[model samples]
Target: MRAPVAMKKVVISLFAILAGTSFALAADTGCDAFKWPVEREQALFPSAPAAQSGAALTVGEAVDFSLAAVDTISFEVPPGHAPAAGTFGATARVTVPPEGELQFSLSDDAWIDVVQDGKTVKSAAFSGVKNCPGIRKSLRFKLAGGAAIIQLSGAKKADLKVAVLTPE
Candidate 1:
């Protein structure tokens, strides 16, 4: 009798765990798929300063710009992925603070690269939501303290917005 009761309790516990996990997954679909909070990035997308390509950018401030044709934009270093014709791209200079990890947020779909020392700094982590209103993607990269080039390529649209932030 004791053994049967213990087995029943284990089965009930497992069932409850699975049911809770399913509910959590169902709740986080679609626009809520991001693993971390992006409220700061979302709030900064609007009213951010408008900046042109090749201009200086700063952390904690968002900048909006119009992307030029991919073939016309000169990148400090070639983008990892070669963009096809009809795609838009741009480059901007930024001095990353000594902070550990920097988050790059974009308002649209695009390939982002942070080049330091003339080489591409690999992204540590990234997240994106398709059809999500306003913001589209966010990426984190560990960059050495100093000047770095921000390369944006393969954007489907000409109008683009970007922001570099220190993750809180």
Candidate 2:
């Protein structure tokens, strides 16, 4: 059996090992700004769009916002997960503006796969991502004149929640 301190040490060691040289640094602005992108709140395609399932964050270029820092981002998935069924993923473009390197990170148990300028840049698997418990995930992107759709995926769509976009 491992003591609480030992368990924490193991987790921290794992995080430090994977995070490389910046595991202790927090986003300059905040942490509660990774909700839906600044776009129209609608389901994808004509097909239900998987609500209570996942959200498509449509981010526009030339737009920047601030966030309130948090501790973690929790993610929860269905009982059994499979690939062929596509474990709830999302899609988004970088929008028209052509800028710099867009950074993205995740909180809780959720994960994000980014498609920049019509190409896949990064993908991550966050653990224990649940309904808006905590969100410290951060990702930045360089504008490229178009739109970016950030599709989210996991076990249960309703189980995950990041900082939702301020209602417009």
Candidate 3:
């Protein structure tokens, strides 16, 4: 009976040590262990003709904006015109200058897709970063001077910073 009790104690001790070690390893690896709650606020979409509209952005300019979890912004095409989807996350239109080139970058924890003429031209996934805890990505494209749309989406509770740079 004494020998059996001693063996049981040893087994329990080993189990505890193993569990602790596993937890430490997971922490060190920066595992995505927590989920953030999504906000219930409605997304804002400015009118196409508004001064704040993406279509108002001129060539050789850069626009920076922040997006909340599950939020999206659409740019209207053909400078100063509204998108068919209304003022919602569906689409944003911007007139790319003739032979113009644009560069786009996003902070960690967000996804971006660019659509032109109903086709997806550029897409990138969000990656994890040690310092920022989000993804960093960039894409460049040449335009033929017409309407183009930029769509942005992000994870729950995660906010993202996006920058759009146009050629000078």
Instruction: Specify the highest-lDDT model's number.
Output: 1
lDDT of 3 by residue, 67-161 (tens): 33232453332222222331222233567767657755444433455667766664322223333233244456666578777765542323334
Give the residue spans of candidate 2 off by over 4 A. Answer: 1-87, 91-107, 123-133, 155-157, 162-168
Runs of candidate 3 exceeding 4 Å displacement:
1-59, 64-91, 123-135, 156-158
Candidate 1, residues 48-139: lDDT per residue as tens digits? 88777897988888889888999999998889988888999999988888774789988998999999998999999999988668888989
Give each model's clash number: 0, 47, 11
Using lDDT as the yardstick, the better of models 2 and 3 is 3
Give the candidates in order of TM-score, highest first. 1, 3, 2
Question: For candidate 2, lDDT tens digit of each residue in 1-168?
Answer: 757998999999998877864534333123223343422211211221223322333332111111111112222322122222423333233333344334443333434544454454443322221332234344444434455545455523323333322122
lDDT of 2 at 33: 35
Structural RMSD, model 1: 5.0
